[model samples]
Target: MNAIHNTYWLLAAAAALILIGIGSSLLARRFGAPLLLVFLVVGMLAGIDGPGGIRFDDVAGAYRIGSFALAVILFDGGLRTRRESFRGVFAPTLLLATVGVVVTAALTGLAAQWLLGLGLVQALLLGSVVASTDAAAVFFLLRAGGLQLRSRVGATLEIESSANDPVAVLLTTLLAEFLAAPSGIEGSELLRELALQFGIGALGGALGGFAIAAALRTLPLSGGLAALFLGTAALFVFGATGSLHGSGFLAVYVAGVIVGNRNVPGFANLLSVFDAGTWLCQIVMFLVLGLLATPHTLGDALWPALGIAAFLMLVGRPLAVALCLVPFRYGKREIGFIAWVGLRGAVGIFLASIPMLMKLPNAELIFNVAFVVVLASLLVQGWTLGLAARLLDVALPHRDRAVRRVELDLPGSLEREMVGYAVAPGATILIGTALPGWARLVMVVRNGEIHMPDVAGSLSSGDYAYLLAPPGRVYRLDWLFAPPDEAIEAEREMFGEFSFDADVRLADVADFYALPIRAKDAPLTLAEHFARRYEHTIEVGDRVRLGPVSLIARELDDDGVRKVGLKLERLGNVLVRRPWLARLLPQRFVAR
Candidate 1:
């Protein structure tokens, strides 16, 4: 009977947790506080002191669950990273993760010692634990909330947050062990341990990621299944490295970069799953931590906690960022922005639990300090991150004139066509051109004139215009207008070998492929007819052919079939090509 009751209770608890998670996620958007905070509050409500009255005082279980959840979350985060973003930011990010963490920890430790009268060990623990920024926190807040910034600035923060946590966790664990040992390890030994952790973690991560990428390229995994298998492999790497006394976090993060950069099959769908899983892990981890807290214990340490929190926020974080960024030539505003946005959440709380579990002297005090710090970070730094970005003048301006790709069929074409090109400023060819061929503008909407080009006409960044061109020559256009290196690659679509600056005219385009079929004054599908005359297979799934361009297939939806939308290019057939070295090496890899 007792066992039966236990089973029923467990089932009920699971059901309640599900309902709470769904409700909290929905409420999170309405409330300015992050969704994880809501989950924490909800978990607290379900605890002994709240309506649920469930006594969940299982610290060991909590720790086990938290560790597993965090490992998976970190691994997933790594697998979805873009390796190129790390190029310029790597040196600075590394310094921030290493020297910056040490400096911040030391500064905060001193402050804690002076302000709160904490012992040296306790102060160091507090500092080290809170030193690293929370990956889950920043990732969710900045990206999911649509917080935008300049490419470099956004890249720096994202990379730093993702890169630094493993080091902090290492510090926390090592420090905790040292403090508890009857004969504490020597400082030299501690340094050695730190070096080993980083060495193994970084090397393992790089090797693991490369191995996974190589395997995926050579392996025969299907798209959907490949995504799942890749995620699992990342987790395996993290666990395997950590179990060998190495930094698994580093391994996982590095692995993610490798996978993220490569053209893996079904990566988009996998990214979706990884992001969703990360949120779930964060909610559960934070909520469990919140529920485990006793209000009475927290209340006792409140004043000191507040003091420590204030010191970490106002003094420790800013100083660290400023010092680390100086060598990178970051401007004042960029430095200031990074400084202000060092929001802490679950990581600190989880670290505090380490001391509590070990029954360290003043464990409750540490927990209270951690809790206060977490609250302050969320309320102060997290909320102000966006405003700070704007104030610093580092926010990237949003431009709506960027090119958009759309597929249009001419009046009576049995086949399809692909078009791609960019509108250049002061384009001579557009000045004396005709309606379908001369207009050059693909976005002007009146009279089916997409857009008009002028001497001062602003070219939309990353635009791929859809026009009817020959199938074999579209690649020439893509080669022409590929953005200056480092621009985000736009999604690919089908057009006759879509590229930039080809001589395919708009009317010629419609006439060639039979586009603009919906309107009364539609042009002829000459491109489509050309495809039929050549005995080429120009089906729905096939690529469109301009004289030299080709567009690939993307989707078929309710509105219409969507292919790679490219525009007719106006330049004569001069294929702008690069040298072999330029093609082989990324911009960042070149020696100074």
Candidate 2:
């Protein structure tokens, strides 16, 4: 009877902690606190060291929970990552994920050895534990802060955060093994292990991802069932990869990317389910880690942990990022922003658990110090992320506001989704913008009454319009429904005053504005110039400078650039206002 009562009490406590964590998120967002930190604090408060006085010290249990939670979180991150985001970023991102982790670990290990007085191997283990950026923390904060980073910077960070975990995990495990049996390990064995971890993980992930995608497309599964199937299959892949001594984290994340990029039925449903699932996983993982930590024990290692955290954030991360990104030609601002966003969260704490599980020397010290480091990181770096992005000029100008969008799966179809949007006042569609040729309007809801597109005539403010569009191409429709103010602000501020057809000859524009043009390049059109300048596919917002003027790609299509916006590089405000006078004078004189 006492055992049954104790079990009931444990269940209630767990439920209460989770609920409190969820509720505290509102305050975290309102105050710009890191949500994971809030969850961690809640669990700590309920632990034995805190007022709640719940005595729980279960390292093995916490490790199991953390591993599962991390797998789900990584899978969710992969599913949301669009394949187009990888264009022109794969090489740099890969370097950051692999070589960058090693550089960061090496730099941080030196600091740990000096501060914590640990042996070389143990110091490197400590460094590797906290090396990789946490995917959960990065993904959550980027969305919560409402940041629209430049394509290159954002994609690199997202992919690196997801991809680097496997490298860090491998490093930590190898170091822990070395500490456990120093005489038995060798350099050649370590190299072989690293190769197998990556090679096998990659091959397995790719195969599993394709299989999952194919099943989702062909199976007649409902939305809920499809989500469950995907979650289970992802875990299966993770387990299978680990059983083969490969990096399970890498396999699961890669599988997620493949499945997400493929055309599968019930994608919207999968996203919605995983969105909630990832949140739950993060909360649980943080809570368990928090419960595992004893705040009183952390006091002994607090200062050293704080020192290590400070060094990692300032010197270690930035130096590694600069070294890794120099060959890639990343701007100073981009590199700085990426280094600043290298937040350590559950991954660090989870990795620290391995030392405890292995019973290595100073294992308890490592866990306690890691706990402090995570806390300090959340308090300092997480708090300043938004400001850093803005100060460094890495965040892109806000061009779109969120709108009410609903996606519905079409039965018997894997290619199309029925997307619905609430037409806002001053929406481009409400004005004169036309839907793409591939999009077909099906229905509209006005005043809670549903009507066919023909009967509805034209969409009005507050009217809900539904259209069938290819899943991959639906994002292109968002601009048509964007709020008027953001659209106007974007056009006026970032895109410039005048728009023209992209097919216009550069020679004609140069003659009109008195721009200096080389004889060889005089005959090139704006589209041709963009194609020549950018090696990858040209996207909207891409800019090419021609002497004093900048040509911005304002619109795109299957063929190439459709429209371009001209901005005076130096005298944009002054010359734009005096358009007639500016046209008459040479651009050099206008600049003076």
Best by lDDT: 2
lDDT of 1 at 324: 92
Off by over 4 Å in 2: 400-419, 422-592
lDDT of 2 by residue, 342-429 (tens): 9899999999999999999988888888888888888888888888877876665454434657888653455677999988888889
After TM-score superposition, what is the CA distance of residue 524 in candidate 1 from its true location, in Å? 52
Clash tally for model 2: 0
TM-scores, each model vs. reference = 0.68, 0.80
